[model samples]
Target: MLSNRYFTNGIDIYFDNVCGSMLDAVLNMTNHGRIAVCGMVSQQRLSQPEGIYNLFNLVIKSITMKGFLQSGYLHLFPMFLEDVVRFYKQGKIIYLEDVNEGLESSPIAFAGLFSGRNLGKQVICVARE
Candidate 1:
C-alpha cells in the first residue's frame, strides 16, 4: 500500500515511459489526470504485457490518456529542427551521444538500448561523415 502523502492531492499530469507496475501506481494516484503514453520499455520483451490492476481508476477519476509517435509528427520536423538548432547554438541544450566505432558494433549498440547499457543516444558510426 502506498502512503496517503504519496497522492494526497493527486497528480495533474503524468508522462509515462516504462509501463507496468509504474503505470499501475500512476493510475491509482491520478485525479482527473492527463497521461501521455510515450514508450512501454517494460513490456517490450515480455511474452504478455502485465495487466494494470488500477485501470478502473482511469474511469473513476476521469483521466485522459494519449499515445504519440515521433514519426506522426514528421511534418513538423523543420520547425522542430529549427528550435533545436537555435537552442543548441544558444547553449540552452546539451546533446549526448554514445557512439560505436564501426558497423560491426551496430548489433551491440542496438542491444545496449534495451538493456540500459548505453549511457546516451546510441550511434553506430559506419564511417565518420
Candidate 2:
C-alpha cells in the first residue's frame, strides 16, 4: 500500500482525518510522529470497529496524537477565510472539486467522500447560480 512504500523511514508529522485502516497503518510507521486527528469517517457506519494493534508503537516511537474540532476554533474563521481568499486571488491555491449535478446525485457524491472516489472536494449542486 502507499503507507508501506512511502513511510519506509517513518513520517515526522501526519494530518489524519480518516481514522481506521489508514490510521492503523500509519501508527506502525511513525517515528516521533505528530498526528493531528480531525475526523474518523471510516468508523462512522461500523457497529464494531477494528481495534488498532500497533498502538504500543506510540510509546516506542514517542508519537503524539491529538484530536480537534473545528467548531471550537470558530473565532479563527475570519482569519482563515481571509488567508484562503488571498491565496485564491493570488493564484497560489487550486480548488479541485467533483461536482454532482442535482439532488438526485447527492447520495453518491457524499458516499464518494468515504470511498476515495472523489479526487478533492465533492460538491452537490442542486441549482446553478
Q: Which candidate has the top score in lDDT?
A: 2
Cα RMSD for candidate 2?
4.9
Q: Please write out the lDDT profile of model 1 over residues 20-124, one tens digit for every residue.
A: 776787786656789999888767997988888889988998989899977799999999999989999999774458899999999988887664455446788
Clashing pairs in 1: none
Displacement of residue 24 (Cα, Å) in model 2 is 0.2
Root-mean-square deviation (CA) per prediction: 7.4, 4.9
**What would the per-residue lDDT of candidate 2 be over residues 15-129, giving only the tens digit for each residue?**
7766777677778765778889998876787789757787998899899999999899999999999999999999977545789999999998888766445544688899999
- Top TM-score: which candidate number? 2
Full-model lDDT, candidate 1: 0.76
> Which residue window of length 10 is worst by lDDT in model 1?
1-10
Give candidate 2's whole-model lDDT: 0.77
**Over 4 Å off, model 2:** 7-9, 81-112, 115-129
